[model samples]
Target: MSGPPAAPVSGLRALPAPDDGWKMLLRKEVLRFWRVAFQTIAAPVLTAVLYLLIFGHVLEGRVQVYPGVGYVAFLVPGLVMMSVLQNAFANSASSLVQSKIMGNLVFQLLTPLSSWNWFVAYVGAAVARGLLVGLGVYLVTLLYAPPRAAAPLWVLAFALLGAGMMAVLGLLAGLWADKFDQMAMFQNFIVMPMTFLAGVFYSIHTLPGIWQALSHLNPFFYMIDGFRHGFFGASDVSPWLSLAVAGGSFALLSALALHLLKTGYKLRN
Candidate 1:
């Protein structure tokens, strides 16, 4: 009898042609919110709109920020940025923590994809959601308080940078947190307080001297201040300094996120 034919090689099949796992993961993350547009997208937009309506009504005539810029108009960009930053972070941190809690993360860890791929997929998806949410808030707010673009480039730059920074921070939070409570603590205890104190509702200059100096220490203030400058052509500080702080924070968080993934700090566990 003829000997058995040679067995086919296995576990080394040219890596299956390097499938588009990253793209697929990205698409899946995008679709995750799209499928539930009401919760993920509409809710935030509506919330921001409500804030515009309530505060705009109360403060519109009573307060004025920059010369020639109405209070409502002044508030729009800050709200938009706030919504973007918060939701962008929520997207990634929630996704990661949920995956870990539900035991779905193991499926991701089992894949041949590298840490960089994971980083791109998750962060890209978070940024995309953030931009979409920011756009939505802007469009809705226009109905109540239309604002002129004093520096469109600044608007674009700060929006992208703020969203990216928060996205990276979300990644780090997700990697570090073992549960939703911990993530919530990160958001409520840290992110929320910082954003609220960042002059989202008022000018930092209006605060007392001590508060004004304290505001400078909060990086979120620079983000909001810089974004507001985009609408008024004026700000309390240099736009360049804001850019440096926001960009620097993003770089630091990004490096930390990559390092965590590479070292399998919490992700591998």
Candidate 2:
């Protein structure tokens, strides 16, 4: 043999392949929303502002859900949380459904990334969008009627839990939906009705006994109610109970989403 196999190049030694698919996915997801900031973030914030102006003006002094708390003030946190939950879910669900429909998702499937990587990237993007939207709503609302935070931690806890729950649900919806119509059905019929009936603009205590019982069955109620507790230090239910409900719902949805991802339900199938 003339010589040992050529030595590795001096300045270009063999290197291991990089595992950066997760990074790429995350960057793409983030940039996807960032590039259209107005649509991803601003429009939602504006919609929230409109809700505040319209609702606050109309119901300002007429309604007082919590003792000594202005109606507008009482409404702000709930609205902020509501905006967060919806946008978070929308971000992931729309992205996944669009990618699948457009046949672009195949590129991702070709990567070496694991299913866990896919789950993390999508859910992370959704949570980021949700938090940003929630913060946007909060800052904008400060101009109209500032909210009080008796238990700031409780507020954050519920916000994070709600966002996490919705993000996972979005992922599941995206994976389960074969078309945009199905995703739309989920949002319009289920998410929309639940958010509206969750008492974001009012208190459940004012509802009829049967309605109150029904509201308790909605997990969204726990999220909004628990978040409200952070502001007013009071709620229709104990914050602990709210936390339990929100946390449990989040766990359930997350498990479902992860399962769908692992099984490649509508994705690879």
Candidate 3:
């Protein structure tokens, strides 16, 4: 009587909408790193603490980057920001490359998710991992020296911008790379060098004029400098300038990453 029982609904199911699709992918990515908390989260925190102990021991009372700020205190913020940047990049890049190598990336490709969905899910996961590692390092380093936040808003702003920038950069690296070795090269030759040269352990003001000029060229320098500014209310450059450079760099990288994803550059293959 009711049209033969509504034709016995089809066996096939509809694909998830963009909103729901991204949330599921994001949950999967978060769980991927959460399942290995020791390696993904704890390991980085330990490394930052080691850096603090070694550098803070040797440099404390010997050098002070800003007036009235101890070397250890100054070092804490740098370590936190460094951990944030590195872990963010590692999360997205490693996940993508590993999935590609394991032949599991095709599962993601088969989803009805759009490029925007992929970007938000992957970058969101990276940001989560990055902030978590940063917080862990900050809390642990407090045992050694507590860095005060003179401008808490600036600190939060730079931290978010820096994490977002590195996450997008990692997405680009993942897309361009085909194997682990290539990924290693990108990390070692590019990311590590930039972070180290970005005035993490020392201030650029101590460098020669030429070197200081070079330091200004590094975007990582702006990130760390701006973050350090939040603690001491002083920086090599204006915090607003750092905000502009960091914000602009993040935008450019995000646009490139989105373009690659939309075009299926290396992902479809």
Candidate 4:
């Protein structure tokens, strides 16, 4: 006998139409934060503004960085980078953990989304959130002083690479963590410390020799330093070197993220 009646067609496609699934997932991830703009977007912008005002007011001439550049000018890139880094991590990590806790992760795992598709979707979404916040931070900071673009391409490069690296790392963290508290501990203890230490407020040159050397080891340093270079055309190190470090980290994190998703590590269990 013939099947009862043809079911209504739905937007979701099967494996053969992988693009549809990938796009849908990406859109879903974007809308997730867009829906909470006040919390996700507006709050970060406000925080960056406050930081620029407070720091710029207190340390205008007290802190001399890059010789001629004002302290306010130096602080903008760092705040933008900080916003990008934090939000990028938050987007993917929160999405995955929430899905897991709510028992909807199985639905995603059962989909036809390939590992690469998952990577692109989650990371793409995270990167979008990051760039959005970074741009917002930059614009907000500009109200205090002009945003001179010394090397626009380099600025774009760092923003994209830095955001992508964190996005992949977030995916990896999401794969490893079983609960929200565990992710919070990771963010608070590890991510926050690393970002803050990445030269958000002052030049690494101001630090003691040993601390300066230690800063060199932080990938976040490369991100902020390189981005600042895009603004002032100077940084603690060569922009090319920063590009290499950030680019390498992005590739490595992408590999790790894809591997976890492919193997269903901690996710399937």
Tell me the TM-score of each prediction against the true structure: 0.91, 0.91, 0.93, 0.93
lDDT of 1 by residue, 1-269 (tens): 99999975322122332677878888888888789889999999999999888999888888977887788988898899999899989999989999999999888777766677788888998999999999999988878766678899999999999999998899899988999999999999999999989999999889999999999999999988899888888988999999999999889889888777776777656
Measured with C-alpha atoms, the lDDT of residue 125 in candidate 1 is: 88
- lDDT of candidate 3 over 148-200, digit per residue (tens): 98999999999999999999999999999999999999999999999999999
Per-residue lDDT of candidate 2, residues 129-212 (tens digit): 999999999998999886588999998999899999999999988988889999999999999999999999889989999999
- Candidate 3 residue runs with Cα over 4 Å from true position: 1-19
> Model 2 shows how many backbone clashes?
0
Model 1 steric clash pairs: none
Point out the worst 10-residue segment of candidate 2 by lDDT.
8-17
State the lDDT of candidate 4 residue by residue for 1-269, as single tens digits: 78799865232222343447889999999999999999999999999899999999999988878878989988999999999999999999999988989999879877877777788899999999999999888887778888689999999999999999998889888888889999998899989999999999988988999999999999999999999999999999999999999999999888877767666677766
What is the C-alpha local distance difference test score of candidate 3? Answer: 0.91
Cα deviation in Å at residue 238, candidate 3? 0.2
- C-alpha lDDT values of all predictions: 0.87, 0.88, 0.91, 0.89
lDDT (Cα, 0-100) at 131 in candidate 2: 96
Predicted structure 4, TM vs. truth: 0.93
Residue clash pairs of candidate 4: none
